[model samples]
Target: MTNVFEAQWEASQVEAMEALRAWAVAFAELNQQMSSWLDLPTTDANALGQVLWADSSGDPLSPARLGQRIGMTSGSVTVLVDRLEAAGLLARSREHSDRRRVTLRPTPAARERARAFLEESSAEIAAAVQGSSAAELATSTAFIRKMAAAASGATTRLRAARS
Candidate 1:
């Protein structure tokens, strides 16, 4: 039996979580459209994004690593890698100490195209936030970060449960 104020707070929390979920789905749809701009499906688009992120982070990319990042299976990753390689978007090598560990990279042209597309989207986002107060932006950023952490924890728990 919760008090009235506690119940109200819980309700508000639920509403905020729902809004977060909706925002995530909308963002994914936008990303899908961006992928279409590259003439690639959502899976490949996500995989490409992960590869680019790894590269930007100065971390090496590989098919196995990408599959883990994108919630894809080993076979699916292999085929996805094959298709991207065939499309001239992905470059593969074996420079790692472990000869069996294949490294992945995005082609310069593909990376450039993705960068251009995202720049346009980011400019739109910047414009959308133009009138927002600094405090508002900080609050929004904090909320998003908190929600992201919770969601990531949920994913790990669910994956472990499945295993």
Candidate 2:
């Protein structure tokens, strides 16, 4: 026999899980649309997004680092960079400290386009979240962070297990 408090907590957990799932689905769909709008292939768009997020200062990312962040192999990252460079969306340069190391950076045009696309997407997502109360938004945000951390940890454990 479950106590009333326990039953309510279980119900809240269920609701939170359902809401998280729905948000994930919706975000994926929205990302697809935004990629289409930007005329970027999903892989390229994702790579671009990673670059935008991980970029510190104006320097490009090392291919190895980018690959690690995006879960791609070095070979695949090379291919991805090749395609992006060919499209004039990004360029590669040798690091000053190490001529042997190549780094990938977005072109000026790509940066402008990415910024506009992100602004539009941010507006859309903001509008959606605006429908929620402040408390609900805070709860959802914390729940999302918790879930993301758990997923990331699980992925790491799975990789270690496979190895």
Identify the candidate with maximal TM-score. Answer: 1
> Model 2, 1-163: lDDT tens per residue?
5665455467768887788889879877876876797688877777877776655366458889888777999999889888888888887878678799877777887788888887877886777788889998998688788998998998999999999
Candidate RMSDs in Å, in order, are 3.9, 5.1
Off-target runs (Cα >4 Å) in candidate 2 are 1-9, 56-60, 99-101, 128-141
Clashing pairs in 2: none
Compared with the true structure, all predictions reach lDDT values of 0.86, 0.80
TM-score computed on alpha carbons, candidate 2:
0.75
